[model samples]
Target: MRQYIVLSDAPWRSVPSRTQQLSARFRGEVLYFEPPGASKRSHRDPGRQVRPNVILYTLPSAGLLPVGGGLARPGGWRRQGAFISRAVLRHGFREPLLWTTCPAQVHLLDHLTYRGLVYDCAADWSRLSPRWEGDLAAAADVVFAASPALADHLSPCSGNIALLPNGVNFPMFCRSDLDPPRELRGIRGPVLGWIGSIDERLDLSPLLRTAREHPRWTFLLVGKVLRNPLLAALQALPNVHFAGRRPMVEIPEYVGCFDVCLDLRRKGQDIYEIVPRRVFEYLSTGKPIVTPLYPGQVEAFPDVIYGAHGPEEYSLLCERALEEDPAWVSQRRKDYGAAAAWSRRVEEVQQILGDIGLA
Candidate 1:
């Protein structure tokens, strides 16, 4: 058994990722810290129990150490690092398998004691500085990237980086035996669905245009919606239903009910290389998908999904996807998700740990 300390950039409330999956595999206990907002200190300290051996807590930031009214002191990097150190010790964590997904958490290296540290580069965090990137790479026993583009991006900081793609829970998502989620039972089909953050990265235009062209087709979007004009437009459309955020356990049932799925990422240099998690999740269900023609999308699902090149064909491709036989499509991509399961991906991570003499 091993003890692990995981510092995360995503809020505890968000969807699961590689960091969470890795922690789940460890036989020992894990103290997982959640990301704080804008350097503010909240009074929360429950350390929510996520699994049998894993607990989660949000850290404090120096910028917002409330002073009853407004009296902020030095809650800078050093102070925040010290705060984190104390928290780690408070949970009886010492010399554990320390991992961080956030490059900004590199500062914790200066204050905490750990047996080994691994930097998993799964996100393109905007606030990360070049100095921290180098610091993290130098300090990390292993640095894993979620994509080929990400591995190349980190090549400047380290020569020894591992390519670790994001994975799905295959059995949970790929099976068609589960009944449709109760929330989706009454919703009309020719149903189109999408799951993940409905943020700016999403190209809402395709959904808007498709819904307008075919009002009878009900579009189900399940995820948190960040403020955007496109979201407002989608909300106004009578055919679109925003299910909001649902529990992770219910996600598979939600996707299982879909006649088809959509992956519409906006065109930009920022996320041109991102292989959205939903793409793999939808693939697990063997549901036919329609997406934008991004390089990553084209490479990952060339034969599996319908890629629309221009705005003129977005709705047309979706219409065509509805014609695909679900059972045939499911069988075609049946083994693909098995190779992309989180368990298989973490097995590789365990080997990395063994190779580095940490196991």
Candidate 2:
């Protein structure tokens, strides 16, 4: 058996389900080391053991701090390096692959030596801090950018950059188009739905204004409220219905209830170019999408109805979607769905690992 260790901030639930699925395919056991409860702070921490054929480090988000946060600490990268160094000292595995979404980890590369490093640029992290991102790009051995535009941005730093856009779990989102569950059945006519955490990244103002403008159209907002102010303001909108967070198994049923879907991401300094995972999930549902226009979005999903960055365009797009034929949009979604499966994306990652002799 080809053994491997997945070093990440624990409570494994925080890690993306796609990453979990990919790890399982490698015929390896995953050991999640929770950051808050990690054995030690520095790389020399004891009680840490590294006995595996391969050690894969999954980096954490740079901006979000740990629970009870005081200045965000380095848990993912630092702990990973500690384990890798220990493995080198004990078993002599000289090179390990550092797979990370955070661009800041690039600076720490000088502190440790590995055979090669793979930067999974899941989002346009450079937007957060351009200078820091440049430093990170210079350090990565291979850059797997989530989109072609992201790859282009990192091209100046690494020649090995590859475009590996986000993929969907077909089975999870693409359920039988049966009626929605009883809880969602009461959501009134011309239902336009949006599902995701109520976070700073969500641009709910446009959705709120749009819902108010068209009183007949009910807007269903799903997912938990991470930020209270945003949730409270959205709840005040008379046409908007807050479904709150439901179980993952029930998401599709909620999505199916929508006559049209919404993927309204706030055009922030961090997320303007990055595509949200929910956009793909909404696409998988074969519902017409009313999304904000951003750089590279036109190329990413040419089929989506691009709304201008304000309430006017958003309201117009929603009205257009409501009037449009569902069958035509549904067909386009099915076409796009086949190409954006998680299985395909994982295979690409495996190929990259094999090329670098990490697989």
Candidate 3:
């Protein structure tokens, strides 16, 4: 079987299911590289493994400040350098194919004279600096975009750009026979849950407003708190419950516990083209989703309850979602399930890779 290395600045657990699914499809080994202390509690350090056929590296977020010398002026760059120095550069791999999930790492590709591909999976390019996009376009042999809008923006730079949207692990998120964990079971009222990093990108104001408007409902947030002050404010609300970040394996249990799932993306120009991972995950759970309507996203997921600006629309949608019969909701979830399967997505990616000679 062919071998591949996935060089990421962080551990695999952050995007576990996606990494595992890709690993299975390529039938290749993964060589993840994280800073010394950044290893996940459950998995082995991927850097310690032997070299593989490909090196997939994730880039730093462009929203971050620029560090000196073209490095992201943030902590991630320092961490990334540690991994690259200790694991990647130190190794002597034979003609490894390079794939970068980060746009920032495109500059680093010049140092590696080998077959390479760049997967610019982020939907936040409109928010990214023009220099970063230019660097990515110049470095990547094949650029995989996350949406059509993103592709349009990148078209001026690379002809090899391909639109590959996000996908979910079907079996994990799909309606399962498994029982819900004890912590999730006792939640008395309708649970409006949102799972993801609580950051500025998230418009929790509307969710909080809706929660306050409908005091009877319980709002559950399952993820790490990024903006502490903002999150603390959200926590101050009586109906909101911040669950912090849960283990990846426990995510499905949390999803299964939701009466309705939320995709509360803050309305921004960058978010217009972004299709969040939670949308597919919510669909897989066979749960109704309440989200803001973006042109690109609505085109992909028309069944979602698209809320216009304001708490009234959001609250009404949540009420409607909560009122739906469990059987009907399950069928809607199945409808979404049929549409966003990873198998189909992987096939699309495989075709893209083959066209670019990366497969």
The lDDT values for all models are 0.76, 0.63, 0.64
Q: How well does each candidate superpose onto the true structure, as a TM-score?
A: 0.85, 0.76, 0.76
Score residue 167 of candidate 3 by CA lDDT: 72
lDDT of 3 by residue, 79-156 (tens): 444545444445654444555655566545544445565554545644446776677776677776777877777788
Clashes of each: 1, 2, 6
- TM-score of model number 2: 0.76
Q: Write the per-residue lDDT of candidate 1 for residues 27-126, one digit (tens) a residue.
A: 6888888776544545156677898888877777645333232223434656667766776778877688888887666766767788998898887754
Off by over 4 Å in 2: 1-11, 14-80, 83-96, 107-114, 124-136, 177-179, 226-233, 269-272, 294-299, 355-358
Report the Cα lDDT for residue 9, model 2.
25
Among the numbered candidates, top TM-score falls to 1
Residues 262-285 of candidate 2 have per-residue lDDT tens digits of 877654633426566677787777
- Scored against the true structure, residue 251 in model 1 reaches a CA lDDT of 90
